[model samples]
Target: METPSTSTSSYQRDDGPVRATLVGIGLTVFGLLMANVLTTPAFLFDPALLEGLGNGSIAGRTLALILNFVGMFLAGLLYLLATGRGLAWIDLRIPSRRDWKYIVAGGVGSLVFLFAFNIVTTLLEVSAAESQIMEIIGGDQTMILIMIVVVFLFNAPAEEFLFRNVIQKRLYAAFTRMQAVVVASVIFALVHFPMYVAFADSLLSTLASLTVMFGGALIFGYVYAKTDNLLVPTAAHAVLNAFQFTVLYLAIEYGIEEVQAEPATLAEVADAVWTVAVALA
Candidate 1:
């Protein structure tokens, strides 16, 4: 019998594994420093000072959002510095033609999966169908348009690069694909812990949020697997966030001002299921 070929696969680069380990360490350090920096301002600075500008004013909210966004970005930069990689290795470059095609497909797939999952949960007595964050924002068409543009340009893309592209990709080199995804997903969910506490409004809701996000890591991972391009996954991530933001905005503006007061119930759950089934059909 002929000896089996043992030639290494071309996808296995010389530096991938070593670089991945160092990057993971750097990311952990970066996250710690970022938390410290953000929390410090709260102690020395007056909470009222920010509140005075406007309680949940658009500009105030925007500033807070920017700070959170940039803080994570700085963390990612720290990782790059530690790993001796530049911005390019972080997968921050603009998407190419091929990247855009796969990105659209991934985006569509993300929406489809999101809808399906919601449907399943609804049938299981989980929730009613409701608009997501972006849907709410979109009701104010002018503001929504601007927010979408900003998100598409910066907020969405930046987060994707930091969490998924740079960090997740590097981790993949060290761990099995599934292991890498779990690590990445855990980090992704932890960073948004506050959101789960504030918006999710219940233990079950929080767990659901965890499931959605980790599943997101898998979807993004699928995009990367197909294209070997970060842009595709990044775009998908952006679309998902923007969509959620819009939905939440609309929900608040139109009805159900307080999530804590009125929880998603059995009827809502059925709505969610029906919506997904129809969409899939």
Candidate 2:
């Protein structure tokens, strides 16, 4: 009888409990909560935390940017420590040349799908998802820029490594592809609960985010299954995030401010409904 080749098998057969990754995610969440807590004003009489601190000067914006970097770095570190993996994973140096090609293609394709889906859903109106998204994001271009940078460059990489490459990969070793996607997607969505609560009033935006995020998880998981490599999904995630951020910047740059109409178009309403139907299906 021929022995099973270890090389053809998944790495890390021990497949330890995703404790480390979960810990890392937890610590990062805690750090964010702390950041928000510390920044809050001491009293009602005082102005809001981090409000107008830089006087709209370059120094102020630069300081804000620096702080954001610090936050991301700390959160990433905590996540790594909890997961028992060194920071090397975030560099994502394992993917092969073929992996890169697939990642790029998959990422771009997913972005296109998301963008088109949003446009259609917004037109259909079954969900008020788009406006809610804008509200949670807040109307601060500087802050939004900082967020985009952190998410794409720092948070996204670390998260993909932990969630997809590390945790999901291990899980898939014991489950089917669909099961892996479902588990990974649930975890991914849970991580964003804070953001959802922070923008509770934006029902449409919240729904939109839920759909986008879960859909992203499913796509990334599928990529991993196809390639058996973390690099593909990580790169794909980064591309999608960067693309979305770019679109947002373009909209803002073009002076597309808040929504003008009280009730969205019937088309948008219908799209929202269909998006939900598709997601549910």
The number of the candidate with the highest lDDT is 1
Error of 2 at 203 (Å): 5.4
Q: Which stretches of candidate 2 lie over 4 Å from their true place?
A: 1-8, 11-91, 128-148, 197-205, 228-230, 258-281
What's the true lDDT of residue 187 in model 1?
A: 70
Per-residue alpha-carbon lDDT of candidate 1 for residues 184-233, written as tens digits (9 for 90 to 100): 76777665556555555566666666666667767787666555566778
TM-scores for all candidates: the values are 0.68, 0.61
Q: How well is each residue in 1-281 modelled by candidate 2, as lDDT tens digits?
A: 11113212533434334653454356546656544443333322233323544234433443443454355445545555676755543434466677777787778667566656667665765343333334324445665566566666655665665566555654554455567667777777666666655644566656665776777788887777666665677678776655545445544555543322211211132233333335445
Error of 1 at 200 (Å): 4.0
What is the TM-score of candidate 2?
A: 0.61
Stretches of model 1 off by over 4 angstroms after superposition: 1-29, 32-56, 92-94, 128-147, 198-201, 248-281
Q: Give the least accurate 10-residue stretch of model 1, judged by summed lDDT.
A: 1-10
> Relative to the true structure, how large is the alpha-carbon lDDT of every model?
0.56, 0.54
Candidate 2 yields a Cα-based lDDT of 0.54
